[model samples]
Target: MPTSKETSKTATFGVKNIGGINSTEISISPGVTVLTGKNATNRTSFLQAIMAVMGSDRASLKADADEGHVKLDLGDETYTRTLTQAGDTVRAEGDPYLDDPEVADLFAFLLETNEARQAVARGDDLREIIMRPVDTDSIKREIRRLEERKDDIDAELSTIESRQRDLTDLEQRRNSLREEIGEKREELAAKEEEIDQSSRDIEEGRKEQEQFEQKLKELQSTRSSLESIRNKIESQEASISSLKQERNQIQNEIDELPEVPAGDRDQIDAEIDQLRSERQALNSEISNLQSLIQYNEQRLEEEDYEIAQTLAEDTEGGPSDTVTDQLLDDDEGIVCWTCGSNVDRKQIEDTVSRLQDLRRDKAQKRSELKSKIDDIKSEKRAIEEKRNRRQQATRRLEKVEAELDERDSKITALKQERKELTETVETLETEVKELESEDFEGILSLHKEANQLEFEIDSLESDLESVTQEIEEIEELVAQEDTLRDQREQVEDELADKRTKIDQIEADSVEEFNEHMDAILEILEYGNLERIWIERVEKSVREGRKKVERTKFELHIVRTTENGAAYEDTIDHLSESEREVTGLIFALAGYLVHDLHRGVPFMLLDSLEAIDSDRIATLTDYFSDYVEYLVVALLPEDAQALDDSFDRVTSI
Candidate 1:
């Protein structure tokens, strides 16, 4: 015999009644075979019997049978199971259950109610109804991400190492530069020391020079005054010679005039001696004044040189930017350099005026000294004439004895006056010699200034070199810092690329889920559904209260009205007849899959009255022809609606 191709052909499965029927058997076959009986017949009881055989323990048959059992046979295998008030037990032997676990599993799945079937089919977790493979691509992608992370870390480590090397090099360079700077500083210090010594020597030299200049000025001033005095002395000597010649001429004339005038000559000599004494005293006073004037002029020259040397010693850089000319130009408004205070122009003017007055006083004193000298000469002349007159009178009177005594007294006074004059001239000459001496003061001062400046320059240069070296080192570090930043940016960019790849992989995984959903829709012939989706509902917000509802899946469809308007509706809102048709279709598909896979060729169904009585038997016949095996629950009227082809239906 040819192997039956029909899904319901050549399979024997057994059923047991646990509630209404204690024991019963219903045979399943292909082709239309109707079950016909009265209204109260146990056709529904028989359907529950089949459910008990399939592994559903919830189905309770109304039979008085003491026990329930189901036996099934495929050509190459047989299976059996039993049910009781407590539970169901399944056993199979010599069947293809080992080849397909899905087949054995389908038997249990088919026994569920339409609601339960819908729930399982639409569930997000469909492990019970489907097989899923491990996501190898995701694993590989994760591994790739880890590997990329490791690579990035390795790159960072390299960058850090390079930076460390750069730092080391920079540090070494910094140290070297510092060492060089130190050596330069030491050299500069030595140079500064040399310059200091030179400056000290210069300062001492300046001091000596100042002394020399001062002494030389004094000597020059004294020499000038002495020469002037010597000129005056020459003039005095000439006058004295002229007076002597005149006196000699007068004496010759007198000698020619009278020999008898010895007494008179004696008297005249006495009076002339007295006049000479007075002239000598005046000459002495004049000589003293000249000496004082000469001394003062010498002192002024010494002071000028001393002040010059002192200024040079204190001089800063050759000459101050401030000039004597500027000071003199603004003498009327001169200010002190050191204190920024005004010099009081009146004070300076007064000082200048006083200096001029002192010069004028010196000139006056010289004139007065000259006048005194002239007066002394005049006295000498007068004395000579008086001597002449006295000699003439005495010689005539014979009082020559008295004239001799008077002449001796006059001689004594003249000798005293001559002594004072000689003393004054000698003092003036000594002062001139002293002023002419050479001494000076500015060399040492310049040396000291140079030394101080050199020291400061050395110190500043040392600090500058050190700072420059430090700046160079800092610049190197800055370069290294820039490199590090660039490396970090590159690493970040790489990481971003990796993250983008990861996102792409995740998107692909979601695509796979969508593809799997399409496949499920195709298998269910549910292409007309408005939307079908699966989710684990976290929360359902309704009527202003958050009601948490965990629904695994949902199927939504749009129904069309007779007026041709379409409206979205859920399976729960469908008419009973439509639900029945949907449920039947679902059962038919499941049974076909199970049968094709060599599972027990059986279906267990209940609650079929939603279809009209006329359509009832037709549905039964359709199931019987469409499937290899089926067990349907119905009233006798429903069974009568089936055609007469259905046979061997066991009544409870």
Candidate 2:
């Protein structure tokens, strides 16, 4: 190839000899230069020296005794590079002391092949080229957008599932409640029937009771008539006795009852005396019992005194009130002096109360003993009175009884008459009994009425049972309804929560996607990108078989044209030029997005040698005017053809 100088393009890089130049200093100008020399003649070494000086690549070098040094004129600044190979590594001096051992590793990346050389030699800026094709910014933005959409979809799916679950639960509860309601309705119907039957039974019982009452009245009237007959008979018999006694007494010479035999009287007197003696004994026994009871009472009083002393000693430092009052006021337990342990105030109060009960019991027993003594004395007086009455009656009875004996003979004859009358009365009583036995209408009615009442009560009981059963069913149904209502409320709450989550997800996704798209569009010099959407294929039916689905993206570009006309386009069918422009816009967008998002500052580009030279020139001018640092790989020829605007040139 001819020397690059013939093209008159400025060189992107320049070098000048410094301390390590061969006995001379040479300034490299801004133009292409050709270095022709045999291998191992310091040509490659010189290149390394220049790159090392510029703080660029240095991978191919061997250590020698001396340091190779050079100076470089990068368009903006000057750098002095010096290198000394130490075994497999080299030391470089450019910026500061690259003390990191790996600092000398630039040699590993040295351009060793034509491909590597051509890649670096191209003057096309890598940043520009990357910005030239499908914008990395747009791709990244689209990816983020899709991710956000996916998150939203996931949230929506969760909401749907939750709603479904809640709805299903509500439906199940409703079904259960309906079943319970059905049972309750059935029970209510039965209860209504039972109540009606109970009312009927009550009515029947009342009617039967009326019949029994009427029959009972008739029976009572019949019994009264029988009573009157018996009284009359008794009076008539007494009349007959009086007449018979008078006749018999007239015959007896004033017949006094033979004075009760002295022996008989004596025997009676003995019985009376014995009774009096027994009463005397009971009085003495009662007196002794009183004395014993008094002794027990005294003993109880002594016990009371002891208990009082014990209580006073035990509660000396405790509450001053009565035991019960202290218990009411003192919740914290008192210390028992006797046992040096905690004593519940309530327990002490209870003990005191028991002592009072004992006292009352002792008093009650004393009173009871006194009452018994009085009763014994009263009984003895009654016995004495009976004895006196017996003595008085003995005198009258001796005289009157004698007369009574004479009257008794008369009474015998009267009794015969009375017997005859009694026989007639017996005959009447038998007839009455026969009349009663005739199965009166009242008796028959009573039996019938009792039977009816019993039947009514039975029916009423059956109806009450049915009503109770119905009430139980209603209660169960009400419980079920309550449960269903609670479940419905819960379902509503769950659905509300799910909806909120879904809404939140949708909002978040939309915001993130918009932010990302805005960032990319700003970098591309395109107006707002409205949206990035993904379309998924679904439900393919072929050969009578349904097939699963897949998804693909359709990139949408929305921007205002240079003329201020709004335009929208799809990625499917674009001219070569349009595609290239679109790609470049996308790449620019990517870099801007990367910077915004804190990505790497450098851009590495490959394969831009296909553009025509005119197009390449325009792109170069555009890149030089726009972005920052760019590293491009290109064909050697393409590199040689770049205009004189490139900042720096280095073979790969």
Residues 1-652 of candidate 2: C-alpha lDDT, one tens digit per residue: 1121222222133333322224223333332222322222333434434444434433223322345555544344444655555433345556521222121221111222211222223222222222222233334444554555555545554554555445545545545555555555555456545544543454353444454444444443443433334434444456546645654553242243233445754655565566566556554443334333322322222222333345655666653457634433455555443464446646655554454345434534544444454445544555555556556545554665566566556656655655665565466445444443222434443433444443344344444454455545544544455555555555555555544543343343334334544544344342333433222223333544656542222245554556767677554444343334334433443334323112121223333544544454454444433233333444445555566555333421
Using lDDT as the measure, the top candidate is 1
Worst lDDT 10-window in candidate 2: 101-110
Candidate 1 colliding pairs, count:
56
Error of 1 at 12 (Å): 5.3
- Any idea what lDDT model 2 has? 0.41
lDDT per residue (tens digit) for residues 381-404 in model 1: 555666676577545433433443
**TM-score list, all predictions:** 0.31, 0.22
Best by TM-score: 1
> Roughly what TM-score does model 1 have, to 2 decimal places?
0.31
Report the lDDT of model 2 for residue 97: 17
